[model samples]
Target: MEIERSDRPPSRVNWLLRRVMRYFAAPRLNMREDYEKVRRVQRQLAVLPGPRFHALDVEIISADGDHPIPVRVFHPREQRRDEVLLFYHGGGWVTGDIESYTPACATMADLTGCVVASVDYRLAPEHPYPAGLEDCLRVARLLLADPTRAGIEATGEIVLVGDSAGGNLAAVVSQQLRDEGVAGAKRQILLYPVTHWDHDPATSEFASVRNHGDDYRLTNTEVQDYFDLYVPDAAQRKLPTVAPLMATDLTHQPDTLLITAELDLLCDEGEAYGAALERAGNRVRVHRVNGALHGFITLPRFSRSLREAYDVINEFLDERVPGKDAEDAT
Candidate 1:
């Protein structure tokens, strides 16, 4: 069970996190060192318990077969058929992998009755920008082309789910699919997604960045560092795929469910995205998780809130995807 603090006191878990992160603070950092630190933090997620979804590991082969992408697929042990959720893990586009996100993917598969494919996309400062996004799209396309191995039918409804950097990729991939005349994904779920690299408070009017930007798990300094590492080029950051908020067309994008943590710096931009999608004539839902931090989905301390967030997803999928409820009942 996870604790719920209505008072929200900067989240004791997150406060301690801030203290732990201080040790790694430096100007010129090592990529290996950063990955090690994040891996240590991600291991904590293994301590949390949840429903059992049979997990499988396999390489998602791309066309030309130069390099295989690693992916973790979670299928409900009892359910024979379910929708597909292609999940992209978030670590500012640098850290985090399928193992780090196993619990969430397993829970998502079991709870939503969706076969969850948690992609281990390439990271930044090593693979850099577009590499991760490209890997994500390739996995989506390959799975859509033939999902049988993952226990999903070829024609099953697919949804894209991601957090932070992964959310950005999901949004971008949806647009790409739209442009390419692909009609597969029906919905996208974004958790505290980094929608834009350049966010102007005056223009966005999202005060969360100013109010809860610091002392929280995700700070302005760290955010900037992420951009420095992943998107070294300022010009590339403005691209629609890099920053979906800057995208000109959201008309044919999948139905969107954007989740924002009240205390997260990215909250405003995330909320702003929902409105933009709605204005573009797309069905959108933005829910601000009150008194929550950015990475609640992975932290055991926030499991109560995390569970609620999963419930929110359940309800959303029930409404948008259709047939999910019937599958769950069985």
Candidate 2:
């Protein structure tokens, strides 16, 4: 069972976390090293089996013009060419790759009964801002243009799903799709998405001691460090497209499933974005997973909550994609 600190005041949690921060609080932002650490942890977690999904590796072009972005696509146990999903990985836009995110892609494919393509965009402080965004858009367009290449069905719609930084890319790519007047992706799934560069003061109030499970954890400092690596260039902070919360308009985008973590710093932005979408008259579902922190979806064994989180994701997908539940059973 997951422990709950809801009864306690935020100050008490902060005080307790201070003593333990050294062990859990990640180091100062060293984009490369921190990125590597995340990949290593995810690699260890991926070894454990959860659901069955097939995988394949492929390549695409990065916005940097010449660099090739390696990608991995996950196909469900029983799938037709009609269902498709474009997935972007979360690694503070620094270290994550298709391999590091295979477990998640596989899990999503199984749950959603759709083919999932996980993109390996160039990381920040190297490729930086618009570069990664461009890579995401290019791949999405490429996938939609040639459905057969990704085994996408002629009748099915494309869906965009992402976590953390990748969630940011998914949002931008979805918005761009609308802007381009292309209609293919029917919806988007954002997992504890980072919707804004500006960390609202209210959200940061409970920065310390947010754990996905007793074993897998993330502290307030770690969140800030990730942002630093992701948007190292101070100037890019004002761009709303980089952070969806800043987008002038939230309407006309696809129906959205916004997941937020109760103890996470990004929670506020995610919830706020959901509210914005709802206010814009768009269909939206905002879910706050209690006793959880950012990155919980990636750590299933360390915490039962992670697996439980996937249950919510699966349910949401089943609802969005009718007949998914029946297909998953078989």
Candidate 3:
């Protein structure tokens, strides 16, 4: 059941409309079929025109040397400092690669004027939990140690960004960094991140509302199923490292920008995490985009709220670390 939307101006023209069209036009598939469909859509996205910026393809050796992780680095046309963004793309931890998030990464790099490194981490049901987290941390350590490789300062601040499962990774990595006292990532950007494994009915209601009419895309059942595949053991829920919102301490981490799709099942959890951050006295800005659904960030064609999302994010980056362009204009 999708959410009943008010007949007003949609805050943005993103996937909500397209998915709604699909919901009516296509037949609802079973979990296996849905999984295949997701893959096909992702494959289509892998070839789209990504955001254009100064870019380089590179690889970082795993800290443990088990394998080398590939990363795509996007720099502002004008080099500025050691400041860089470490972005992880969301694909429910099962799919998605550097190509899947190309557009958003490109846009973020160009808009923020910071070198953006999109990490292609290990996926789950094959690699499992900490495998992805480990890859992200290893690459982060490597980047912070030498941001200058991409013309960024070695000691410059690093910002972590992710959407959906990628958002979960961003939170996990930042928390780990805080524990180790790794500096530079004073901020994190979460776009409709899934912060939990629990799927109670009330929250399911929210998911239904988020996709009330458009059932072709993400559904509440699908969310639960994905959790099953990624986490598997319910016992893992007790580990805050695994389920970030379940973590006891929220203090000492960098400030956060949490974006939620008002119609997304993950919406409530995202807000809850932001609230927790606020309660801990950390700076937090939460934006719930009305008429939007999960994964809207990737659908630039239907994203009426994309610019708004970009502004909210850039504003946060601006206040924390002023862009070089601002300085030049002064």
Candidate 4:
């Protein structure tokens, strides 16, 4: 199958920004020193002043009975939906925290008019694979069990939303919840998620890895570095938890709204995962944001790609049928 393409190209501003990123930001990470550097840089880039929203910080005990996970809850100025969004921030499973993502989460709560709970899961290298994943799962279960615990007056479905590695966690958590025979997330929204384990052009099948991996903000080498840090064991990398696309069973997943960035290395695999879900008879809508890069959601609200993404997200939350405007938009 052909990967979807957009008729429109990147805007002049986006083009210039991509050039700058490629020059300065798109380098393979050094697991030792770069972790802190990346965290600092992400804060600089993502922690901008955003629209005001009520926020609260709370702690949820981990299922392992070991420690408490920090969760930040954001309430929009006007609550328009009863559903709450359980969000997982993306940092290749390593470098992001709730504090670094506050601005983005606040914007999402305001834009979607839904209460947003941002989970601060453990990172890799120090915590590794199951550690972060477990923290996310524990938080999700607690919220699903009782939204009021997080200060949400939710009466509707609890939607799982995440970007990049967080998207990976959400997909796995949804499946695990189904396996447990519990009424878990009924809907999910994934933004440029990391679905597959491999990005090597020599071995991987996705053409996007070969085409856009090196030029955009997220590079194949950088992704490989993240995996090495997150899952040290290569054999475990193929597991369904680590790579959702590798799962043989895709049945009974939540209704999915999958958004991929046109210029991202993970684009094709994300779309492919959506196709697999559709084949398994799940409600799936795949939207490719034209001329957008991975992590575009954290860009300033005025960004064209960011605006288009929110439009798609709000439409999905509202259950509005997609209209034809862009190539393979929905």
TM-scores for all candidates: the values are: 0.82, 0.79, 0.81, 0.90
Task: List, in order, the clash count of every candidate structure.
Answer: 0, 3, 13, 0
For model 1, how does the per-residue alpha-carbon lDDT over 1-330 read when each residue is reduced to its tens digit? 112223333443465676555444432344434656766777676645655558878887755577788888887765534568889988888778887788877767776777888999887878888788889889888777778655455456678999888888899899898889986477899988998875443444568766655556676666667787788897898899888998888897788888888768798888888888989987787777777778787754247667767778887777844673484367
The CA lDDT at 183 in model 1 is 65
How well is each residue in 1-330 modelled by candidate 2, as lDDT tens digits? 112223323422555574564456454434345576666776777676666567877777654568887778777887634457788888777767787788777766765667888888877766767778888888888777775555444456667888888888898888788778886466788887877765534443223223322222444455556667667777787687777877887778777888777766676667777888788877787777766667777764446556666666566566644664484367
* Tens digits of per-residue lDDT for model 4, 152-199: 777977899999999999998998888888877878999999999989
Rate residue 121 of model 3 by lDDT: 91
Evaluation by lDDT, superior candidate among 2 and 3: 3
Least accurate stretch of 10 residues (summed lDDT) in model 1? 1-10
Scored by CA lDDT, what does every candidate get? Answer: 0.76, 0.69, 0.72, 0.86
**TM-score rank, highest first?**
4, 1, 3, 2
- The best candidate in terms of TM-score: 4
Best by lDDT: 4
The better-scoring model by TM-score among 1 and 4 is 4
- RMSD (Cα, Å) of model 1: 5.9
lDDT (tens digit, per residue) of candidate 3 on 261-293? 765667777788888888887778888777776
